[model samples]
Target: MNRFRYSSHNLYSLLSQPKSPLHPPTLPSQTLVSLDPSSIDFSNSNQFHTNSSCSSTIPSVSSTGSCPDSALASPFSIKFRSLHLYRGGYIDKGLLVNLYLVKHHCYGTSSSVNQCGFRNVGVNELRYFASHKQVRDILGMIRRKDNDLESKVRSMNVSLNLKMCSRFFEELNNQKRDALAVCDWIRYAHPSCRNDVHSMVIDNLGRLGNYDAMARVLSEFAKKKVRLVPLAFEFVSLSPLKEATVMKVVDVLKAVEEPTRGSGLCSLIKMFSAVGSFDMAELVMQLSERKATFYKIMVVEKCGKGDFEGAADLVEVMRKHGLKPEAKIYNYVLSTLCKHDKSAEAGALFEEMLASECAPDPITYEIFVCHSCKAGNFDLARKLLDRMNAQGIEPRVSMHGVILKGYFNLKRFEEAYEYVMACDRYICFPAICSTLARLYVKADNVIVAHNLLLELIDRGLRPDQSVYTNVFRRLIDTGRTALAEDLRSRLSSIGSKSTMGAG
Candidate 1:
């Protein structure tokens, strides 16, 4: 089945030249604009109420990914023709079968990524993409070790082939075959693949209780003249750290003429630290002061285990050890806190960044604002926006859109209306303005809504016929015949009614 796609670019064109900012319109003598959405009987399939206004509130707003229920026609809604419904969660028949029949799940298929397919896509993930005959053949080749098919797999994307081959090797019982499969993929499928592949093989061997083969694989990888990736040290730690293995791994690390490249030595320290060889990790760290990121890695590891306090302590330890934490390191910690909704802790981390003189960048502030808005705390979000402006960082449209969305979500329409009015200059996108106007018209604030619609015209964003007709109809119904007639004449002057919404 084809999927829906939406773009931020305007869907309508301007029919007339930009006008001056719209002055407030005169109200009708009689308050006759009925906004009680329930007054209209939505049960009658043939019944179309002019005052029926059911809205998810924001149109042209990006779909939140999750779907929502569409209500009966609301007087405020100006939809041309669109009805969203999940067809019992069914898709194309062939694609549906393809989803379940492959060897490994292809979690990253172009369409399935957006669909509710399994995430992480290991073990059974190949099934998702193996619907392709060539893909299935590649999977078969990897399993059967058909060396002749190497070129075929190589022709595919490097990352993709690597994933399939890696999955193939992981299910192997023989360590030598596993090692051979990885080498086969690298030598044929993607000779230019990074040392991470070799490390992956070594890690796999260790997981399979084949330390001897793991050591052999490491030796073989070392024989290659290419630079070893940081993952080399990681896999070494994965294998047994016996006298021979430890010495072998240490020799590899020490023999490297360039220790800083790819943070090889730092990775060694991290591996040692990760494997409970902290004392060795520290001793190895003494060989290089460029272990700032590794220090953060340890902090991150702490955060992963829910030891946020320990993570913070690790930062202080970093200072004591003469390792300066960069803004990026602090950012990782801050973002993690925000992700976990630890707002109080995130605030502290921000203060700590300022205190440490590790200047926070625009990204740091943006994360804070996004999380704040997502939590529906518009007050904090607004304050953050103000703080960003005070710091000379211009606010982003995404942030305003988020805050406005929060107001609409909370059903705080009055506040949302006032906020929209306050930022009309910045909220210049025709779609968003029209959406807000629709909301206003639904709420019986037709005059305010009409003013906003005119404001769009002045800003050079002329909404189409549906929007114009809807507003005009509401205006006439509310006894504002003068304003309605004037608008009708203005639209007719250019003969633009037919051209409106044409886009």
Candidate 2:
């Protein structure tokens, strides 16, 4: 009989289970807080319960219906039941599972070992039950009413199954036109998700001209450990997202210790050009210690926009970075100087452009000619025109119009008329007629202006209200009241007929 008892004890030892699922061994009789039922406040409860069967520490039930050891009770079954109640729409879950997992992990509970699995199961169940199109529709409506709840659900799914989240991003990347989905997936996917959704978003957003979304994606990526490529920087830099937003992204990237030496500097230059924030662009160049061809282009563009000081500063920065200013750069600076009414400086820059090995293009000659005319340097304008002709670059009708307008502005109607006739000889259609009309009106020659108007009409060029008004006022001011009235009636009839046809 003693031998039989020893054998039975050995068999029992073999069948025995481990004490807990958690590592480092869990302590016995520990109280865990329940996050279910959603409305019962347990803040005042100091009760405790035991999990081990080794001890029989029964709690006293008070007359007020409070159990002494309520805190230590195994509330897992109650919480699971509460999830069912929530699914049935009979209770508020309110992220109770998330709260439980967080609290249990914090408190070193053995039950926290299965938190990830449990959350995954909960999400799967939620997705399964909510899969019916009608149910999904309803849930979408409900979610719209409570964005916080929706965010919590998304956060739970991410924390539970990062792989699944990554797959969602992969699917989004394959979509052709659904850029919105790509953007949303990149925004909410877990950091551990394998596919780089952020990069995909950056690429597509740039293509789609969705600058706002691109900036947001850059900001999100900036928070992660992933390395940003030069193209991503370029996308963000060229986007229409504001400087403050771009700066915020830059700050986040800087914190991540991203090296900005290569194409990063080019992106910064483009970004500054887009927003007209040259100082910040220069700061980035200084920090990056790299200069690119795009830097010169950006400076020229700023000069074209009449920002001469910015263009000059950019030139200085380029030289400091050991980059020689090209012909394009000089043209931009000169154009900018002319726009700012600095004619002498502009002339000096033009001379400098010619002296340098960098040859001027047709556009450079046009800028100089126009600026000289505007500055009352008609002689200089003529000189540039002659130089352009010698270089085998024939001036277009627009160039002739510019010179005629300058002569007209200087009250040299005869010279303006001569240029108008020259424009006609060059087969410049509308410019010749428009210039003659203006010159005739200015010289109080309404008959010639009327004839030019008729020629414009014969050429299928419909003059807008400004053109008609100028002609009519000229006729009336020159004492041809009857012709002015007749022209007014004709314009009104034409406008009404066009409106009716459109309708």
lDDT, candidates in the order shown: 0.52, 0.48
C-alpha-based local distance difference test score of model 1: 0.52
lDDT per residue for candidate 1 within 1-503, as digits (tens), equals 01112223211011011322323333333422324332221112121235323333221111233312321221211111111211222233433233234312332223332243323323321122333565566556656766565566555534334565556555443323555544554544333365556556655554455656654555555556444454545445545554345554554455444422334556666666565565565555555444677777676666666666666776778888777888777777777877887655666667666778887776777777667666665665666656666777655544455555555555555565566556544433454565566555555667766776666565545654465777899999989999888776655555433222211
Question: TM-scores of all models?
Answer: 0.48, 0.40
Badly placed stretches (over 4 Å) of model 1 are 1-164, 167-186, 190-198, 201-238, 242-289, 321-323, 335-344, 366-377, 424-457, 461-503
Model 2, 1-503: lDDT tens per residue?
11112222221222222221212212122211111122222122222232443122222223332333432112233434323211222222333443443331121112332332233223232321112343344334333444344443444332223333334333433442334532452344333232344444454555455556655555555455444343444445545664554565445434433332233345556656667776666666555444547677577668767666666666656666677777677777866766676654555555544544557776677776676676566666666667776787766645665676665555554455445544443434454565556544544555656655555554444443344567787778878899888766655554432311000
Most TM-score-accurate candidate: 1
How good is model 1 by TM-score? 0.48
Ten residues in sequence with the least summed lDDT for candidate 1: 8-17
Q: What lDDT score is found at residue 234 in candidate 2?
A: 46
Error of 2 at 220 (Å): 12
Model 2 whole-model lDDT (C-alpha atoms): 0.48
